[model samples]
Target: MKLRQKAYALAALLYLEFSNRTRRSSLAEKVWEDSSAEQAMTNLRQTLLHTRDVESRHGFRLFEADATEIELNRDLTIDLREIGRIRAATDAADLATLIDLYRGELLAGVDGLGSEFGQWLSLERTRIENQFAIQATEAALRFGGRTGHAALHKLAERLPYSDTVCRATIELLRAEGNEAGARAAYAAFRNRLRHGLGLEPAAETAELIEQEGAAPVGAQPRTPARRSTDIQPDDTIRPSFVPRVVLLPPLQDFKQASIPRHLAPALVEDVTIGLSRLKSVSVIAPHTAWQLDPFSALDEVRSHQIDYAVESRIAPNFTGDGLSLAIRLVRAAGREIVWADKFAFSALSAQERYWDFTNGVARALADSIETAELQRERTQRDANAYSHYLAGRHNLRTFDLPKIRRGRKSLRIAREIEPEQASIESALARSYVVEWVLRAGSDRALLDKAKLHAERAVSIDPNDGTAYRELGRVALFDRDLDLSLAHMSMAADLAPNHADVLADFADTLVHNSDFNSAQEKIDAAIRLNPVPPDEYLWTLGGINFFRGRWEEALRHLSQMRNPEPAFRLMAAAAAMAGQMDLARRYRLQALKLQPDFTTSRWVSRMPQRDPADVDLYIEALRKAGFK
Candidate 1:
């Protein structure tokens, strides 16, 4: 039967006590421990209602509850109860049956629950593993030959840290006249123990491989030795598992009467199907995703072993002519956003536009997952290509001149290790772009290098939107406006849900004198990322300055945490708005950061469709005390 929250309640009733019963207050407190006492009681009632619904569908109830207590239906056959009955068996057949019935750890990935559930689950898992190890080892010793070897091997895999299981497997292999297999198993286990757990196997485990007869069967399992607090668990080292993602049902808060409610859910279904096509990640089925609460119940979501979650919300844009959909890809571990963007479409857009929207969501989701996977691959440090790439990518985003150079060095090392890697090449190109801009467009060599690396990245992987985005920036700096527009348009088409790409495209549009379109694009980008990077704000400030909204320009620029990059522009905006004191302060800050500042050099490097715009900027800068 398909059970949800009620499953945990059933497990507690079945296994927590010998009577298969619990006080209603106690059960509520355990399962809904994070909620208030009154709320917990309410939740308990709702959970039991859910159980009744399941029972109606399946023809029988698993739970019997009263006003004061909840109990498992005594007549129902439960697998866990059956397992509990035979947990202490000594017979080889009974123990073998128990081993076969036992699955891996209980509630395997369900963590971050309430404290009471977390404690109970941990103790329960330990109890099961401990009992299963003893019984399996005993079973393997009693049932000799190939069957015995198989039993011990299964036990070893289930409890890799168990020295007793390892010794048993090694001896069983030797007794079967497979000394080579025995030695190989010993070597593998020893390496895992030393490297993975950072400790050596017991002396008895080592002696089995050197001499031989048997490693002394029927020995009790060893309690794990204490280790440094910094050591991570086994799952952290195993990066080979495929990442699982769930596309949650979108939150549709449409105030517009014309916008249909079905549109958001339809988009979610389309994106889910698109994500399922990618083999690198596994997509949770739509039925399951729909049943999950996207905003709340994250602990229950993580219980399904979801590595990432794609959450979306749909609403009408400020302009009533269109609908806006915001999408965010979040890492389940830390609940950090890996990527997020907003897409705007007309209420009655073409079917192809919807297809384009879903495609962009899928592509960006895949790219973000790849980057997050790289960041998680920190176990091997410098030797791992992923580590180098992550370091370069992280530093490159800082937008500092020296850090950009350092980022370049790391990305170059990553490229050497994985020659023809498109991600590294794209990042290398971005580093050059940042360095070129940071140097105030004086470094022509940086643009050429950026173009070269971007082209190589495109050649290596034409689908990479980041490569096209970098190439667009290079062309913009090179004064090739037409080429820059084409490349930027292509980048946006390829990754429509990429906020940075949209913001960059908007910046290019501002230089091309498309102020209205640029404003719309920047607004959408900001909506995609509620807490935007300083660069996005800087771009918005520039767009406003060019559009002659000096007050708006100053307002946007003032929001930047580090306004040093745009201090001169801020000064100009402030002066034009008649805030002479603020303007002079900003000018002093700019000169403090760059004493050699001159309006002539800055205006000459500035890109604008009309020379008049540059003249006006220079005029404002002069008023703000710039030489």
Candidate 2:
């Protein structure tokens, strides 16, 4: 099929899948953007020509009888069209069929299509891939030695790079007392890695193969010991002993690249950090939860012997401002969703706009974990602070001077209402930091205020890592490298697996000229929460800039829309590495964005870890055309 035709089919399929049949005009607007009716019709024709027909009128057809309207075949078997039905099906056969239909790219070699569709396609692909991987692994583990071999083999073939699938295959072989087969499978995997990617098998794989070989033929295969599920009967065990709650890692609807794979772990950590602040609740460490899979809520609850479990999923809010999170609380014994809701919040900025949706979810989960009437009290207080904070956060995303001023105004209101609330204070301090960093503000003054706010927040509740994190930001702005590092380090230690804290810490390290360490930290943060904030990419660009990898720096920095001064700095560095004209353009942009931006001001703003590194940036920016 021609590329143009395929693009049309894919577009039509996407429209039919996402939109109502009656909204053809809306679909055309979305798919074709500003293209005229004639052009859209032509594309639709080309798409129909490329699509294969399964039956008469039910194939991939595009119709536009009315100039203003467009429509697709109602009976098309597009992969996306089948996904929902397949996913909802209780029958394994239907799922397998749907899985088989998902082959290669949704629309290969199609560009000029907007990023929104492309992002959606990417997320859908990831979700399907993860689903296939998980189901395949579960099947292999459950019935590998019985009726699951053929299915397992097919899954392994499709997802050859999945360590989960490989491990499951080995487990299946070992379970059937086929040690030799398992060894052979390991050898094959090792050879495939070496030959295909020029890389050796990971240590875990090597260890597993070696351990398998040493085990006796008749001996039972050893697995890690499961946590004790003993529930003692005593007055201490109240009917609602939901005090101990384990937040299982969230599930990602991997429909966008920004959605981090490590988000599950990070989210779990975030909830853990938030819940730990409550003196009444005993939140489980992410490591202690053991079960990371969102699908295994029931199994985890029973195994971990927890009274309640909180599960969450992160998806982009169609509203275009920030992230939307869905959170649910389930009673361990009954496997019922005791509470479920969706919360939306914009990304964090230097100024306040609104409350964090994820924090709201955490707050709700906290309420659920508490016993009876206390739940109401905790919920009301947390709900009020959370709503105000989210509003402040949304305003902060704008990053303009007026927006920052407005955001600060909102934050002041939040702080007034929840004077002792750590989340509220931390959020408000963050807004001030944003103003200091992005707009015109005294770094020292902002840092001093931020320090006081953050310190007060921590004093209110030392266990709350968010407050410590705000303090770390203040330290960074103050050019106190050691203090910044110490505070961020403490935040990470408190919430070892939280993504936001890790990303922020990585940013601090990059600012301090710890390039290699920053890269590792960023990589780890990405792994913990695959979808990092745009600022994380900006931080990466800074790291690359300091390392003199201009091209790599440009790659990271370009991901951001409407370049900030720091981004312009990286762009200038990239241009300096190659084209002088490009360097001049970026440098001018940087100056325009910050008319008051000078080498002295820039140096003063930075938390100088080393006098020499400070000198280096000062010199580089001057050379790149900064005033």
Q: Which candidate has the highest TM-score of all?
A: 2
The superposed Cα distance between candidate 1 and the true structure at residue 485, in angstroms, equals 1.1
Q: How do all models score by TM-score?
A: 0.46, 0.51
The clash count of every prediction, one per candidate, is 0, 30
lDDT (10s digit) by residue, model 2, range 1-627: 355445454554445455625344445544554467668556655544444342234543443234454455465555656754543544456545655665654464555655444544433344445555665457446544444566566665766655456667777888888888887777776566545543444334455766745732212211112323221111122233234567776555445435335433433453465555453445555544543455544444443335457766665565574566666665443233556667652232201211242344345554545424333323235444444554565566556768777767766887787787776677677777877876455545876787788888788767667778888888776667888899999887765555567779998988777877888777655543333456767777777777778777777676666566564567457555766677777777777776776677656556656577666667666667776
List, residue by residue over 1-627, the lDDT tens digit for candidate 1: 134635654555455542788788867766776777899899888878887887899898778889998887888876566566553555556655666666776766665545445544644554456555655676677777766776776676667767668777876777778887887787777667656644445544555665765543322111133444221112221133345667787776544546646555654654554344344555665545766765453334444445567776665574456777766666553344556677774434423334454455455555666435423421222234544665676566577888888878878887888777776788899999998888877779989899999999999877777789999999888878889999999887765545577789999988887878887777655433434577878888888898789998887788888889999999999998899999999999999989997877776677778787778888899999999
lDDT of each: 0.67, 0.58
Task: For each candidate in turn, give its C-alpha RMSD to the true structure in angstroms.
Answer: 23.9, 13.6
**Candidate 1's error at 308, in angstroms?**
10
So what's the TM-score on candidate 2?
0.51
